[model samples]
Target: MPSKKEIEEVLKLDAEKRFSYTIKRIADFEFVWAIGDQHGFANYGDDNGNVAFAIWPFEAYAALCCKADFANCKPEAIELDFFQEEYLTDFKDRKMRLAIFPLPTDKGILIDIEEFEQRLQKELDEYY
Candidate 1:
């Protein structure tokens, strides 16, 4: 695992580009996830992992939560009201409907890169 400082540095770089980061705890581990607009697509992933591009912010957030332990995640839902109608319409037209509805956001939800890294470091300390 990367040190907290390294993770924070990576997240900072992403944030400098206006991307948001999320930290999720799995079975007994935590992973950093990020989403932001870059090169015409909304990218999502960690420093050295698979990335899902060309997706919406909410979509990326939802996908990350799905792979994590929901009980330990934040408590925010992704209501349609959170997004603009035009964006939804465009996504629908492109056949990229959201698989998870009412995305969650709270303590363990997708947060800023700094927060994500901080929380991740805390979780890692507890785990180890």
Candidate 2:
């Protein structure tokens, strides 16, 4: 668990840094956090019809967004391998985007699924 100050510091980072942080941390931990309820996982949709599935590198970080649109949801951890194999394929098929490290106030980084996958893959590849 991250301390309050650490969570605050991470949240204070700019969107780009937050995105990079999410990628690196998820790669390091082999899991990502997302908010969901009994119905299904939470997501944001815009007028343009692009749905964004938000993820966080830490459970504490993900807990911060459980208000407003996600008030009924709770943070759930998804393994990196399952995310890469199952969710990515479904996301690509649906043309969904990824919202990296979203906060209560900020929307974090909105990235295309394929591009986000590529970035994560690169991080994984560099370690092996």
Q: Taking the tens digit of each residue's C-alpha lDDT, what string does model 2 give over 47-86?
A: 6878999999999988889988789999999999999899
The residue pairs found clashing in candidate 1 are 74-108, 76-104, 76-105, 77-103, 78-102, 78-103
Residue 123 error for model 1, in Å? 0.8
TM-scores of the models, in the order given: 0.25, 0.94
Which candidate wins on TM-score? Answer: 2
Candidate 1 versus truth, CA RMSD in Å, comes to 15.9
Model 2 regions more than 4 Å off: none
- Angstrom error of the Cα, residue 74, model 1: value is 22
For model 2 the local lDDT of residue 106 reads 81
Model 1: worst 10 consecutive residues (lDDT sum): 98-107
> What is the alpha-carbon RMSD of candidate 2 to the true structure?
1.2
Which candidate's lDDT is highest? 2
